[model samples]
Target: MRVKKGPLVVIGDTLLDIDVEGSAERIAPDAPVPVVDVEGEHLRPGGAGLAALLTARDGADVVLVTALADDPQGRTLRSLLNGHLEVVRMPLHGTTVCKTRVRARGQTLVRIDTGDGRALARVTDTVRAAVRRAGAVLVSDYGRGVAGTVLELLGEVRAPIVWDPHPRGSMPVRGCALVTPSELEARRLCPPPYTSPDLAARHLTKALHAQAVAVTLGSHGAAFAHAGGHHSRIPPPTLASGHDVCGAGDRFAGASALALRDGLPVEDAVAVGVGEASRFVEGGGAAAIRLQSHEMGDRPRTPMEVAELVRASGGRLIATGGCFDLLHAGHVSLLRRARALGDALIVCVNSDASAKRLKGPGRPVVGQRDRVEVLRALACVDAVMVFEEDTPAQVIERLRPHVWVKGGDYAGRELAEAESLRRIGAETVVLASVPGRSTTGLIAAVQET
Candidate 1:
C-alpha cells in the first residue's frame, strides 16, 4: 500500500508468453534446422492484462476489461488472474497470445508469435463503461484486438487516457494524458526519430496534442515532454555500474500510473516510476511490491520465502489471518475459497497473549499456538504463522498482498481497513454468504441453557 489515489481501467487484449531456452550447437544432421535442445518452458501473463496486473500491484484499484476464450489456455489465463481484478473473459475468442522466443543469454535472436487476433463485438460496451468509471485509462496496443473497440471508446470515455503505442497497429489515440513509447516503438508509431529522448517527447507531445509524452531509451533512460512545453530525462537506476533490464517498462508504467492518479506532478511521477522500475529490474517483481504477509508451514517465513511465494504466485496472493477461537464451518468455507483465489494463501493467526487481550477475561478457548496448528492442518491453508496484534493489518502492510480476504458477517465497512486498504495496495473481499454459523452467537446459545 504505497498511497494510490484512484482506480485504473485498462482496455486491451490478453497475451500468453512462452520462453524457450537451450544451447545452439551445430547444424541439424538432416536439413538446416539448428540443433537446439529443449531446456524448459516458462509461461507469463502478457499484453494489457499484464499491464493491469502491474498497476494493481502499484496500489491502484485496477480492472482489466478484455476478451479471451474458454479453452485450457483461457483457463490458465483466468487462473493467473485468480480474482485479483475484475475480468471479462470472452468464451468465443481464444485467450492465448503466445510469443515463442529463442534466447541464449542476454539477447533474443528469434521469436514466433501466436494467438487469436479476433476482436469480440460485445466487449467494447463493457470496456466503455469501465473507461468512463476510471481515473485513468491505458490502452496497450500489442497489435492485438484491444484497439478496434478502443478507437470507438476514445470519443466516448471522458477519463484521462494513456497510450502505450506499439508497432504495426491502427491506433487513433490522440489527446491522451500521456503516450509512452519505447524508442524503437516510437519510431514505428511516430513519423520521425529524434536524436534525443527530450526531442522525441516534445515532438510527440506537439504532434499528438497530448499533455505528456515519454520515450523510453532502453540503456540510457526515459525522457518526458510535459504539457508545460518543457522536457526532462529521467535516468534509469544504474545498479552496481552495469545494467540488467527485465520488465522495466512494466515497473515504470505501474509507478507512473499510481503517482499520476494520486495527483503527483509529471516529473515526480516519472521519478517514482524510475525508482520502482529500478527496484523491479534490480530486486525482481516480488520485492518491488513490498508485501509483508507471506507464511510457510506453522512458522513465520523469511523475506526470501515471501519473495519466492510472490514470484511463484506471479504476485497474486490472497492474505488473511485471525484467531478462530471457536472454529466453525463459516471460517472453513472462507479459508477454502480464499485459497482457491490465488497461487497461495498466507494466514496469520493471532498469538495467545494478543487474542486473550482482545477477547478479554476467560476468552480464546483455544490457545493461539494450538489455533495456528489447527489452521496448519487444514488442506486449504498454505501457510500458518503467528501475529501479536489483534488484527492482521501490520502483516498486511508488510506483505502488501494484492487481495485482503476476510470471512464473517462483515461486508463493505465492517470487514476492516475498508477505505485505506486500496491506497495501500490491497483490495478487500468480504465472505459472508456461509449459513448458520457465528462464534458470538454460538457462545450465547450455549450459555443460555
Candidate 2:
C-alpha cells in the first residue's frame, strides 16, 4: 500500500539500553581486567523504540507499536517514550529486555544482555488500523515475536514498508517495499558462496518476493537489488572512523521509510539512508540522542552540577572562562559563539579577588556579582560559575567540560589551563575578539573623556 499522508508507524520490540562509560587505567591486582572508574550512566530506548524516536525527531508525526512488560525497565521506557511519541503498547509475555554496555575511552568493554521477553501472538484491531493508515511502516524487528504476530497484516498494508531485519528475526513477508539487512544478516540468510552483498541482496529479493532488498555494509554503505531487475551499490559520502555505530542501521531504515513515503525511488531512498546513517555515526551515533531534560531549575546550578546533568543526558558541555568585568558587546559576541559550539554553555567568571589580581587595583568597573548577573541575563548563556583562582584551572578540572573556549588569539600557543583540559580529554577553542572593543580600552576612553 502507498498511503502518503498518514503518520509513520514503527512496529516491533523495544529494549532498554544502558551505557555505563568511564575510564580504565590500571589492571586489577587479582586479575588482568582493567578497573573501570565509572563516570556516568546513559539510558535510552533501543530497538523499535529508537527508530520511532529518530523519526519523531526528524519532524515526523510518528507512532510506536510495540510490546512492553509491566516492570521497572518497561515503566522507564514508557516514561521516556510516551511524551515524545504516541505508543500503542501490546502484550509482552515476559520481562523487559535490558542491554547494558560497559565502556571505557569510547570503546565497549563488554555487553550484558538480559530478559526473556517475547511478544504474545495477539494482534489488536488498533494495531491493524495503525498499519492501514500509516504513510509508511518501519518494522524494526529484534526477533522478539512482535513482527511475527503482525506479519500478515503488514503484508496486506498499502503503505510503504521498510523492514530492518535481524539475523534471529523471521524472514520478511512477500512484497515489502524495502527489506534492510546487515551484511552479516544477509550472509546468514543466504546459502554458502553468496559472499558478496550484491549477491545476497539479489538472492533475498528473489526468494522473499519483495520489491527490493537492501544489504547494509556498515561503513562501506549499502547494496540493493530491486524486483524490477535493477541493482546497485550506494557508498557513503564519507566513511566515519572511530565512532560508535550502535543504531546506524535503525537510523538508515527509518530514514529510508521517510524518503520512500515522500515518493523517492527505491534506489534514491537507499542512497538517502546511507547518507543519514553516515551522519548519525559522525554525530556520536546513538549516544548523542539527548532524551533527558535540559530544564533549568529556580536555583542557579553550579558548574559541576550543570556538567553532571549535561553529561548524564549525553549532551556536550561547553565552558568559557574570563573576568567578564564590563560585559561589553565583544564579550556578548564571544559568549554566543561559544554557546553555539555545544549543547549547553556555562560561563566561568573570575571572582572579585581574582579579577583584582589580574586587572589591577582600579579595574573591574563592574563588581563580580553584577557582572555575573549581567552575563546571566544573556539568552545565550545557559549557566554561570564564579571561580576564585586567577586561572580557571581548578574549576575546569572539576567540571571537565567537553569544550573550553577563550576569546583571544592563542591558536598555536597553549592556554594557561591547557594542562587541565588535557587531563580531562577536553579540547580548547580560541575565538577572535571583536575589533576596537575591549574593557581595557573602554576604561582608557572614559579617562580621556
Taken over the whole model, the C-alpha lDDT of each candidate is: 0.64, 0.83
Predicted candidate 2 versus true structure: per-residue lDDT over 83-163, tens digit per residue: 567899899999999999999987899999999999999999998888888888999999999999998887688888898
Residue 430 in model 2: lDDT: 65
Q: Model 2: runs farther than 4 Å from truth?
A: 1-4, 239-242, 293-315, 318-449
lDDT of 1: 0.64
What lDDT tens digits, residue by residue, belong to model 1 across residues 1-449? 13433477776777765556566777888988676666444455677776776665433578877777766776677776664568755433544667767655424557888666556656446665677777777777666666665586676766667777767555546677777788887676566534766677887788778889888775566888887888878887554322335356765765576567667776777777776565445432321221112323243345336536665645456677677888876677567556544546678777888788877877788887678778877656667668887677777766666777775456435644554466676766554334355677678877887
Best by lDDT: 2
Model 2, C-alpha of 17: deviation from truth (Å): 0.2
TM-score per prediction, in order, is 0.62, 0.70
Summing lDDT over every window of 10 consecutive residues in candidate 1, give the lowest-scoring window. Answer: 286-295
Cα lDDT for residue 229, candidate 2: 87
By TM-score, who's the top model here? 2
